[model samples]
Target: FQISLPSLKERVQDIPVLAKHFVAVFADKTNKAALEITDDYLAALKQYTWPGNIRELKNIIERSVILEEAGKLTTDTLPFEITHTQETGNLSSFDLALVEKQHIKKVLNYTKGNKTETARLLNIGLTTLYRKLEE
Candidate 1:
C-alpha cells in the first residue's frame, strides 16, 4: 500500500493543529509545565513554507518547548528562518527595503523592544540597527 501526503505548505489549515499537538508531545517529553500556544505563534507557523515538513515542525516545537521558560509558546522562540519568512507574501517580486524594514520591526517585537537583543538577532551591530531604524 502506497500512501502519499501533501507538503505542509499545501495543508495550511493543519498547521495550527499539528503545532499544538507537537507542543504537547514535546512539553511532556521535556517534563515541562503545560504550554499554551499563542495565536500569533500559530499564525507564524502557518506562514512558513515548511520545506522540511512534519519533521521540521516537530523539531521546531521541541526546541521552543525546551527554550520557553514562560510556559507559553510564542514567536520569539521560533528560529529566524521561520520568523523571517513572514515578511514577504508575494514571491513574484522582492522589495529589499520593505522586507528589511518589516523584518527589523518583527525582530524588535520578538525582543520586546530590546535594541541590543534585536541587533543581535538581526546579526547587525548596534549602530547599524540604529541607522536602519532611522531610515
Candidate 2:
C-alpha cells in the first residue's frame, strides 16, 4: 500500500518547518551561522507557485542559508521573483527595475536616508545604490 503525500504548494504551512530543517542540515555541513527565516520569507514561500514543488523550495532555502548574514534571513536574501511574488502575480510578470527601486527606497527609509548604510544593508555597492536610486 502506498500513501500519497501533498506537494509543497498544497502544504503551504510546512514551508517554515522544512526551511528550518534544511537550514539546520546545511548550516552544519557548511559551518555557517544558523539561519533565521523571517515571517516575510515564509509568507513569500506560501505565495509562490511551486512548479518544481519541494525541490525548488528546498533549493531556494539552501541558497538563502548559504547567503545568510548575521543569522537573519531578509527578503533581500531571496531571488527577486520570490521576493516580488506578491507584486508581479507570477514569475513571468517580474519587473526587476521597479522592484529594485522600491527595495532601495524602503531600505533608505529604514536607514533614515543614509545611502552608505542603505547600500551596506542591501549588499550593494555605493555606486550601485546611486544608480538604482537614479532610476
Q: What does each candidate score in C-alpha RMSD?
A: 3.8, 4.6
lDDT of 1 by residue, 1-135 (tens): 999999999999998889888988888888887899998889889888988999999999998998786879888788766776645454545577766876898779768899999999889999999998888
Candidate 1: TM-score? Answer: 0.68
The TM-score leader among the candidates is 2
Q: Clash number for every model?
A: 0, 0
TM-score of each: 0.68, 0.72
Query: Candidates' lDDT values, in order?
Result: 0.84, 0.82
Flag regions of model 2 displaced more than 4 Å: 99-135
User: For residues 1-135, could you state the per-residue lDDT of candidate 2 as single tens digits?
Assistant: 999998888888888888889888878887987677788878888888788998898798888887776687777677777877677777777677887797788678667799999999999999999988887
Clashing pairs in 2: none
